[model samples]
Target: MRLLLENKQFRIFWIAGVFSDLALITYFTVHGWLALQVSDSAFWVGATSGAGGLSLTMFSVFGGVLVDRFGRRSLVLVGLLIRFVIALALVALIMTENIALWHVLLAAFGEGLAVSFLMPAMMALTLDVAGRGKLLSATAARFAGMTVAGIIAPLAAGSIVNSAGIEWAYVMIALGFSASAGFMLILRPPNPAKRTNSSPLEDLKQGVTYVIRTPQIRMLIAMIFITEAFGWAHESMLPVMARDVLHVGATGLGYLLAAGSAGATVTTVIISNMGDIRNKSNMLVGGCIGFGFFLVLFAWSQWLLLSLAFLAGAYAAVIVYETTINTLLQTSVPDELRGRVLSFQAMMWGVTGLAGFHTGAIASAVGAPVAIAIGGGVVILNSLRIARHRSQLDPDLAQSSLDSESIDSRGDQPES
Candidate 1:
């Protein structure tokens, strides 16, 4: 905490992250409810959510290019500003009672695009502020912030939507985004590496090539893609299950989702206090396997209490795995290439998540239980494959594969 407080840029960045994430979570919770109200069809709700993921998947590579070319701070500032404007437009549409399904879809897509850029830039900037020596703690702090927002937003949005209206919830999110953008505008971090003259496209290509050639990064990326595609589909399907299957209302669904967030928050806080753990590869593999198991249990649960418990456990495992993998990547990759690589990572997640969203829609049609069960099975199988190939998947292998220019020339050498 002291280390975090010592870095002015990092403090600013954390504040920005909190605000942006709060807005995002609030939007997602309220949007899901609004879609259900308007369409009265689970399939459409899934598709409405899927649309945003689809947009993010399509534009993530470009988001990476923008971050690498224009710089992390610039990309974040631009993305947040765009989000603020988009949010205001949404407010106008809602106030005029002129909103349609297409307008909602457009707003979701725009938010998705902003996220595609903002995520990678934020990761890169966090690394820049933390430096190599403190990467683990920094990553933990970022995840902790996200967990806090995730936990708070759903309950808050639910209350607002139930009492005031969905539009008020959206208005709250817009204000959050506006405040985040303001903080970002004032943030200026010292550049630790010299700038390059290469085009953004070239830089993006280089980043992708670097990941593809590195066995560890490639394996990790593959794992995340599979985990997101299969293990995390529950999020996309939860609302449908709560309403159609469990006979739960919006408030009940909010509480169910909040249970998972609470678990994730607890995990983040615990990890943050523990400092860095060794054998990060083991942590990644074990956490993912745990995540898959809990997902299976959650899918099969008939009792609400059982379902909530399983969801909470699964979410906590995901938080552990995600935070560990991100720290590994930050510590393993070169500072110069961090922006592009993080962007590529974000892109892979977006694409995989998009696939998951569609899969959820298909699953909802067939029966939520069967779909979730199949997804959980796939997650277990994929995680086992990664564990078996740990040697190839470990980020430490990047030490040998990365070219000189792939990392910052002056950054710390690989620890012997």
Candidate 2:
């Protein structure tokens, strides 16, 4: 941890990551509520959420290919600048009463496009800075920021939206993006040793091929997609849960989300200090099962206090599962393909949005509890399959000849 802090570049990037997550969390919460208020239809809310993440489906492969071909820093700056501008634009449009569902949807599409590029670059750079030796700690530190931002952003956005209106939440979102971009300016990854002169299409093809050829990574990506699609996508139902089940207003919704994220934050801090452990595979599999059980229980609970307790447990298990997988991926993949692999990871968010669309449609027909319970069931089944293949889930690649391959898992190796 001290080594990570002593490295100036990644330290700045960590701060940048927190700021950007603040912007995104606030924007999503504010925009989701606005969509519901404007349309009064759960489907529209799902559509809007789907639209935001769906934009990534169009751009992530290209973004991933480009980041590896060129570099990370400049791409990150441009992406954040565009996001900041879009946030400011939304604030202006909303304040002027010129906003409509289409306008908001347009803004959302723009946000997704920017994020598809930004996140891959930022994560790849993080791995670059931390090197192979510190991958576990560094990845934990990065997500520690995520858990904190989750804790704070929802409650803050909820309060602002309830008091000052949604536009002010957006305004703060813009400021967060600007601050994040400013911190990014100080980051400088070590220069590449060679250039790839191949066309973008060829490079993209190579990346895809590499992922397919690697069994463990392929399995990992599959789990990431399934879990995101069914597990965490339940946020699409939160507004309805607040209105129908909990009878909590938006403020109460904020508190409920904060409770869940607070649990995740505490869990992240606790595990970040665990140093190294050998049972990561079992924990990864077991955590997903635990997340499923807790989620179903939370959905069934009609009491707010009881529901909150279950939600907290659900998020704790989720963080445990997600963090272990992500850390293992970072340590396992070679640096040359890191950007592309991470971008594919980013694509899971899009899958969640699409799955949320279906989940919402199901909820509209069957109710939130039924839809969430089905999702939990699916998460359990899919994660069980992953556990069945737990031998391939090893992060150190101890059983593979590729472990002996001359691959620089760390992008930067500046000499003393």
Candidate 3:
């Protein structure tokens, strides 16, 4: 917590992140609503979401390469600027009554492209500003910021859409992005990324090879993809579960989601204060298992209160798992490869988006509860399987073999 006040660079960056994240949350909320207006079909809503996810999937690696090659702060500012433009463009379309389905899709895709750059560069830059020592606390703080944004952004966007107009909602979004960029302009990293002569393709190849060959990284990436595909995918079916299974309407759905956010907030505060934990891998393992167990409980619970409690527990477990894994990965890698490595996590977001489609399909065949239970079952099984090789998840390798390997591969001096 002191890190926020003691470190000026990180303070600025964190504020910028909060604002940017708020805008992003608002965009997603507004994007769906606007999609419904332009085309009332659920299929079009899915397609609009898919457009963003597809863009993220296709361009994340290239964004990582750019992050490693250019100034990370500069990249973040650029990404924010692009998003600001996109938001204003939407405002114009909405105001002039010229908006179409294609316009919405294009804006979604553009936002995705902007995020591809924003996420990797911002991730790498976190270590740059905060240093590896405070990585976990800094990450927790960022998550806390996101949790705050998640709560506020939707409500604000919803209010604007209801009162003023959709165009005004977008106007608010544009203001948020511009405010973020303003904060970013003043941020200065402790160590700026050095320009590289390596081709983007070559850099991308090296990053892929490094993750594939490194056991710790390979295991972490695999776990993330599996969890996202099977476990997090169930999020798409929440509406169905609320209506059909729990007999809760839209208002109840909001409460259920709010419960998850509340749980995340509590966990984030605890982690932020913990400083550093030695056995992060053990925590990660436990978190994954807990996440699955809670999901199953939530699926089976007929009572809305019990389901909310279970959902909250699941979200808390995920916060633990994600914060631990992100800290481990950041501290493990050399500075040069950090962006590239973190991009893999960005890629997992894309997987979650795609997995929603499959999860929805399964829910169509079986009931939503059964489908979600199956997803949770898969998460538990995969976590157990990986738990057998605890050594690979160990952080000792981060200070020892992995550091040596990263240095040898990149020919960069180790961080002090």
TM-scores for all candidates: the values are 0.90, 0.92, 0.87
lDDT of 2 by residue, 176-282 (tens): 98998888777776643134888889889988998889988898888988888888778877777877788887777777787788788877787767776665788
Instruction: Give the C-alpha miss distance for residue 374 in model 2, angstroms.
Output: 1.1
Best-to-worst order by lDDT is 3, 2, 1
lDDT of candidate 1 over 1-416, digit per residue (tens): 55567888888888888999898878877776777776777666666667777778888878877766666787787888888787788778877888787887787778778888888888888877777777777887887888888888888887887788778888889888888888888888666334679876688789889988987777777787888777776666777777777776666677777888888888887776677676677778888888888888887787788888888898898888998889877777877777767776787666654654566667756877777777788888887888767646554443333544466654667766
Q: What is the C-alpha lDDT of each candidate?
A: 0.77, 0.80, 0.81
Report the lDDT of model 3 for residue 23: 85
Candidate ranking (TM-score, best to worst): 2, 1, 3
Predicted structure with the largest lDDT when compared to the true one? 3
The better-scoring model by lDDT among 1 and 3 is 3
lDDT of 3 by residue, 189-285 (tens): 8788888888888899999999999998998989998898888876656656655778764445556666776777788889999998886877788
Q: What shift in Å separates residue 195 of candidate 2 from its native position after superposition?
A: 3.4
List the candidate 1 regions with Cα displacement exceeding 4 Å: 192-194, 395-416
The number of the candidate with the highest TM-score is: 2
Tell me the lDDT of model 1 at 83: 81
